[model samples]
Target: MSSRFLILFCGALVAFGISGCGAPHSPMTLALVTQPTRKNSLVKATSAKVSAAHQRIVRVEEVPNRVVTQSGLSVPRGFGVQLLAENLFVPRRMTFAPGATASQYDVFLSESKADRVSVLRVRKGRVVSKATFTREVSQPYGLAFWNNWLYVGNTDSVVRFPYRRGTVKAAGGAQRIAGLTKGGYNQHWTRNLLFDRSGKKLFVTVGSSCNSCEESSPQRAAISEMNPDGSARRVFASGFRNPVGLAWQPNTNNLWTVVNERDKLGDNVPPDYLTVVRQGAFYGWPYAYTDIERRIHADPNFGARRPDKVSETRVATVPVQAHSAALGVAFYPVQGGNFPKDYWGNAFLSFHGSWNRSEKTGYKVVRVHFQNGQPTRITDFVQGFLRRGRSWGRPVDVQIAPDGSMLFSDDSGGKIWRVFYIGK
Candidate 1:
């Protein structure tokens, strides 16, 4: 299609704004085939095609950051943490390109502070080259690829540019598709983007403007969807404070989000959360919250604004410890992954850490376990970012590489860490 016709076609589809093909990065598009449904919490390892070597046991180990922190980095015993690239200017979210192989892949990471996105070429688990994909962006944080175009969720808008698999640099200028509320209270300026399973809808996370107050715009404090070209915008879900990450479960295909809840009101009153997001569902943010035990309660200060909504707020599937600052979420592949079958369907999250708490919290990586397609619990996965209440590196985002290794970005250190299993 001609550029003009393609633009109009996309605009017609969205019914409001204009857009282009982009990545949803949704569940199993990379293909983690599931086993038969079972009542047990864990999926049965009955597939002969799955490698049994991944079943070997492993435990967390403490080590040093090697350069910056000088403090120990926590990782599993069998896995090694390799600093892929450093000196990046606030590297944030990341996405592996399509058509990647077990040994070679391309990761596009957004350096929000630098106002650019860069691509890292990895071969055999090591970074071979680094190059800029695009620049002159406004705090570009969220990234996705669909068909032949790449989408970026900037502070003020959702934009897209032509991108091809293995292409290190952008081929053309970006086309702004949808306008967004820019710069929320504090650090809510990061806009994360995701596409639904069928790529028919684009999900953009727009954070609330304040610590805990009624929002003035419909776009604030909500996840909204529109056509690929940015038309027919509508709120997908509401009442979330800061949902930094969005991932679809490989087995059950449910949309999961790790939220950063409101601060203040004491140390452990309300918890940050990992929850399954539903269409039209409202999660208590400025109004109320779902506790660690799965019980719902109204927000101490704002509950009276809408008592009905506060009382009716949906409960979180799993409540993380308060002030953890959950930022990114990545689900492990259930099939065709280098890790053992037991590691399949698990989700990894980045704790950007906390600032307001007197005693800081959440400066590490965590694993969210799933059984029978539902999240069972959250446990420490990678650590060492925090030592004696002082942190040198703050993890921002994480992604599973084509080789089944775990890669995370630490913005404070301006580095990326790759952890891969080496077997028992």
Candidate 2:
């Protein structure tokens, strides 16, 4: 469709101000006019063909010019995915209940639970689609498209769903890509997946099982890469207690991550950071933190004489304020279009926010500056999630839409916000 036609189509689909494409949102004005359904129907199991296929590396054409910008947008700032519009996806946290308003944005609380992932189509804040994650894939989290296959990372393992450009409901017999360390209170168990440029290497992040436990394999708190079929696994880097967000520099092929560090050292002792992941390099997790020398004067929680622990001795790339809880990272590539070249290789980080510190920190998105393939600036790009040290949204993962606009998720706020330039 022409650009003019596409804009009109979007506006028509969202005649009303709010629509739910699986993502959650505030109740609409119509909610007051109509009564909500008492109970929602359960999402039936998908066909065996969709759920049982064991295919790998399916071919997908280049992403559409305006690939769907939003999916499974949530509601209420921080609850569950909205069912309005053509809500194709659902939040891992919500389940519909009886008496749920049909106004698209009004979801009754009685049936709500955390969901894994939701699928939907969104653009310019409008939503389109009714197919949602409500029926397929178990607890989907990380969403990535490689060669037309949709790979979602969950708590325990990663699964693949076959999809085509402009296609919604995926062919669903999701294959288990890899198994992770089992349950633990401190285990940063959410597996977020990313693929390299050639689509050959798959990267999965497994956070530390605990705050600072002496893990036999430092990989416990690190990022790892392997084949999409779960073969030839190797630990990409170690030392991150919980490196939730992972992305590669668009041109250079260098990897980056945003780590949520351990807490309780002090109000502003150790800093949560975004840094370059070096292979076979340690990041000073339970033993050390953002600052190597300061660990000596910092909190003595684990004790002073654990002589075996390695010292940070050197500085790792550091970002914004301490305990800001930097989460997901995404690099906006330099496309051949009119978009500025300066933005081509910049990285955006979502600060999931922090609770352990007395003074509020994080809760916003920041951009990391790169020059000659090294981090030079970590500037704030989006803010206002935290108000007076309390958070309204917890920014998580960030992804670049097909149009080159940036999309990031806020689990705490239950919303996904998009960023783009309006000026020519």
Candidate 3:
């Protein structure tokens, strides 16, 4: 056997505590193999094996499915996961509408497949009543509440309806604010909407029509912005494969988004990412992928795309695992929050899981640790959505509840799950 393979084999055996080959499976054996050595190639090989073994150990230690919770999900100790609502038809995005009382809040959910936005009044931890807020929406995927108006993003246009504190139905006709590219039934047709902190501008995310092709419309593969009244429509940023979720940092005023990168680039070639959205920035889409190494491509349709585009691409704040299908991103606000103090300022992202890859990845929620308003690392916060290579739920969007708990939507299972810290 080659020395590299032998080293890995021996390391695995030692990691699993199996006695083997002339050398005893002891700490000394592990130290000898992993310690810095004179040979450069040997050192590289040994270091890789040791690192992988350490990662395996960490994964095993962190993800122990011994205890199943009320939601039939496995969560870390001191955390609680519960099904808040279920039996909905393809729930996508969720927002809190103003309630009648100070402590009460109405949760608005977009039932995408049903093309309607549903409302449920949740007081404390109980869902009081449920009703259809509006059935006038068409293939509604994103909903946002701003300044007494509820903006609904459909497949082709963004519309706004008058909203009151305690009302359920619209009193007036819907005003179409902006027109979006709705290429019939493509790979990414869902439109996500977000309003700026001041509610002066509304941002909408339009995904690329095809997986890896130059889109005919400039609006596709771009984040478009307009006045709250739906005027002054312009592409804010371009070249994103599928920018799904949009969130503004509480104090920083920085707009961030989780983008789903293109696929078919091997199992781990291109990584999906989260990054601050800069106006007019072009992220590499069909022509390039920005990762550890920038991969530039030449397309027959586009013909000799600019290589400089790769260098011009903004690097991701956090490069998530490829094919993970990162969908939702929401920052845990530090002020008046109910989560643990350590979770303050961190971002929670939902990986909608993988489809085309041979091995499944990302059927859970991950926390991106932040220090001084910048992302440091990613760690699994909620897992066990996948069991025995089968996934029971695919998390799509994540939002922070009024009480500081984390709320995420699972479209596959038609459920909304609430996760919160229960420890001191």
Q: Against the true structure, whose lDDT is highest?
A: 1
The per-prediction tally of clashing pairs is 17, 42, 0
lDDT of 1 by residue, 344-403 (tens): 988888889888877787888987767777654455778878888889999989899888
Ranking by TM-score: 1, 3, 2
lDDT of 3 by residue, 1-424 (tens): 2221112234433432434444553221111111211121111111111122212111111333335687677776778887888999999999888653425678899998898899977777677788998888888988988888999999889998898778877767688988888863235878999988788889999999887776789999999999999889899999888999999987887889998877655666467777788887777676555442112222222323554554455545556677888999999996667787778999999999999878888899987777777664456778889999999999999999888888999999998898877883
For model 1, where is the 10-residue window of minimal lDDT? 28-37
Give every collision pair in model 3.
none
lDDT tens digits, residue span 1-424, model 2: 2221101112312432225323332221111101111111111122212121211111111212221223332211211222222212323222221222222221111001244345444543345443443334444456666776767676677677665555445556567777766455454656677788888999888887777677876457878988988899989877677887777776765677778777655545456666667676666666545331112211244424442344432234543456776767877775642235776777777777767666666776666665656554344566556666666666666665555555566565555565654443
**Predictions in order: lDDT:** 0.76, 0.52, 0.73
lDDT of 1: 0.76
Q: Which stretches of candidate 2 lie over 4 Å from their true place?
A: 1-113, 123-125, 133-138, 216-219, 292-314, 336-339
- The TM-score that candidate 2 achieves is 0.68
Error (Å) of candidate 3 at residue 87 is 0.7
